[model samples]
Target: MSAFDVRDLLKAAGHPGQLKAADAVHYAPTTSAIPPAEVGAPRDHGGAVSPVVLAGSVRIADLVLVVILGFAIHHIQLADMVGLGWRYPAAILSVAVLAVALFQAFGSYRIAAFRSFLKPALRLTAAWSLTFLVVATVMVFAKVADHYSRIWLATFYGLGLAMLLLERFALLHFVTARMRRGQFDRRTAIVGGGPLAEELIRALEAESESGIRIVGVFDDRGDTRSSSVVAGYPKLGTVSDLVDYARSTRLDLVVFTLPIAAEDRLLQMLAKLWVLPIDIRLSAKATKLKLRPRAYSYLGSVPVLDVFDKPMADWDIVTKAIFDRVVGAAMLIVLAPVMLGLAIAVRVTSPGPILFRQKRHGFNNETIEVYKFRSMYADQSDFTASKQVTRGDPRVTPLGRFIRRTSLDELPQLFNVLKGELSLVGPRPHAVHAKTNTTLYDQVVDGYFARHKVKPGITGWAQVNGWRGETDTDEKIQRRVDHDLYYIENWSILFDVQIMLATPLSLVTTKNAY
Candidate 1:
């Protein structure tokens, strides 16, 4: 037996006996561990699972939190009251606060852990029970047990646990059902097809609860480096093919499990793939040092390096959708009277339907029939989105220019938000054939497709910031895309509010509008 440094191995593993002292595959610890560029390369360390997932899991766990905290506090109160007979009320509020904090710290309400509470959950409950017991014991030792109410104390402890567990059970059922329907699933795709990709597939397959369904893998290389089968998932196509596939596929995540050492090739791949509207992550399993420890995340015992994270994953999308509908509905209700007047004006001015419908690009470049109040001569209306309406244009009726300038023509789009085809605020969508000069916007701009990352809106950051109106020049459309991209990069509810507030003021400026 070679007397190796077992302690060092244990320390590296962060625990004793996790691994035996062995020579194993030791290497020089002094090289830059960047991700590989090419396909079919063997990636080293499994990349860390996202910590954002953990934070999200903690928030979701709050579904069962209120009950859990209530129970623990009640139990403590009941015990204090039973001991003190009338003083339990004084201890109730303090105990409740402490229980909630302890629950949060102990990861008692983590969505992953809460999904099953019997084995780990049983341990969690027991641990908390002991914690509360110590607090009760300390109180007794301090001679403060006689003032609490006996019945109130007993009821709180017994009822709190029951409610917490019951609520958790209900929440688990709701979450699991939504997940099964792909309603709560993270749309996942794999990049590369070799040993590393195989490991990722196996790891994901093993964790059924992780809710990752591999859409497919994209590899640039042929069979020599890239396998037709990594684990069991088939190679969907090449890296360039992935660009097209992403546009068409409902992919939520793209995991590039490429080796970090292949820097040149990776940059090339990033150039082609980074333009899409999905979460991109580089897998760090094959790196030499497994990173500086902070880079890797622990998913059970497996440590992984995180490359890129997709924005608005899982519940964030749900929350945003909720916010959209609530705000959209309220706005429509508030603006109903104004919309009614606009409808009447459109009908009286143009002897046609009050609404004008035109096909336009929406979320993911999908064509949606966008509605607007008619603002031009019904017969001469540019429904095909071909002509730019210039100032002093003959195409516009007398009523048309006023509504167009005031943006009263946009009133019908509120119904689009009502129909779930649009959001209240987002990048204003353009017509499918919308182009600057002779070239289309998508072909001209390198990452123009990324603007479709989220849903389109009636009023956008671009419009509110005076990037709206006719795209008469290359510079015009380019500035609009830039502002749209900026809006996407820093979107929030407050950001939307600011843009909405600025829209009316922006309409008054009228720099580009015809």
Candidate 2:
């Protein structure tokens, strides 16, 4: 079926971030587990320039420059500003905000605008001039113009505009260098080969500023059904091979060119590909099915249906990283004395190191060392955690039990948060070999690896909702995974704050923590 039908099927998947089987097809979730050996050593793709991040950063920089220039010009023009109470700072802040709003309304923050020097200079000048005119008119009508000097206002206008243009010129060179190195382009890949794939690739290439770089093509069929090369791009591998390729490399968009009539093939490919944390699109250029204009999103001029979107998009990732480092650092400073006392307690009571390090799966299933206050005895500690800790386990020291139940042992992971290996709120990272009964966590639940789509956290929605502690049964682990997936789908800055606030309350019931 084409996207017209598959779109409806995907709608039934409940959450937009999840994938489910269509009513007509029974998905068994029987695809071979991702070989454990390939979990680490992710291949580097050099550097990737996300347009959203670049655009947002540029916008923020413009605002800062405008505000600074306003203040600098005022101070230079009117050194005796003792009479002005809050008017100067408030006026400059308002002008700065309105100036940025005007720039955004005029489309001055686009990636293409930054690629050239002249276009941005002209646009910024126009927006800045208009911002001054509006503010001056407002001040006059409010009868507040008598409080400000005309000479100061004029100086700010000229100097601020000049400063903004100079910033744009510098940015132009930076963007140009990045473009020459191909860092500004999205690393895209095609999922099918033949006439449809050729048409899609050519259409994308036709747009000179599409910012899409076709890496290669991937198909499961033999050479007889699919060509070895299409539109000057070689076939990289089969569908399974594409999964491994994406996991290792920095792959952005994955466009499927298989015909809409091939429902079974599409279903199977979606089953395998949905687990990946990448954007998946179905090419609608060659499909006979037609949907409303809003139903299809375009890549360049080529229409496609967005099947999946990567969670924690560009700006969200930036915000989360900033929040983690800033808050994590502050927490460390505030709790230093408590942590020191706990360290001393552990060292004195146990015949082991104060800190225990274990390998845990981090973002994208990469192995990272997670730190904790040593809880088990020196010789009895299980670094791999092949054996689960149970209630009243002899390995736990007296001090260790108190720290574990109070969750003071997890304070050391705040360093991991600062190191960018963990978030303050996300799926809790599990030991690489953590399991329930005889089955690995991944085996116990389908799409379990999806939790690693974001960096694991010190605490999460599952923990705050009473899903923390030991998982001895499949049901317990399954519920934890379900809560984790829900958190991933509905994550926001406010949601994270809520989870963090509820964490201490959750620690009261540590019945399951050994």
Best by TM-score: 2
Report the C-alpha lDDT of model 1 over 164-259, residue by residue, as the tens digit: 567557656765665455544555778887788888778777876665777677787877877876777667667666665555445666777778
Task: Give Cα-based local distance difference scores for all models.
Answer: 0.64, 0.81
Candidate 1 displacement at residue 193 in angstroms: 2.2
Whole-model alpha-carbon lDDT for candidate 2: 0.81
**Taking the tens digit of each residue's C-alpha lDDT, what string does model 2 give over 228-341?**
788988776677666666666667789999878886677667765665667889999757888998999987777899878877778888889899999999999999999999
TM-score of each: 0.77, 0.87
Which candidate leads the pack in lDDT?
A: 2
Against the true structure, candidate 1 reaches a TM-score of: 0.77
Cα RMSD to the true fold for all candidates: 12.7, 5.5
lDDT against true structure, model 1: 0.64
Total colliding residue pairs, candidate 1: 40
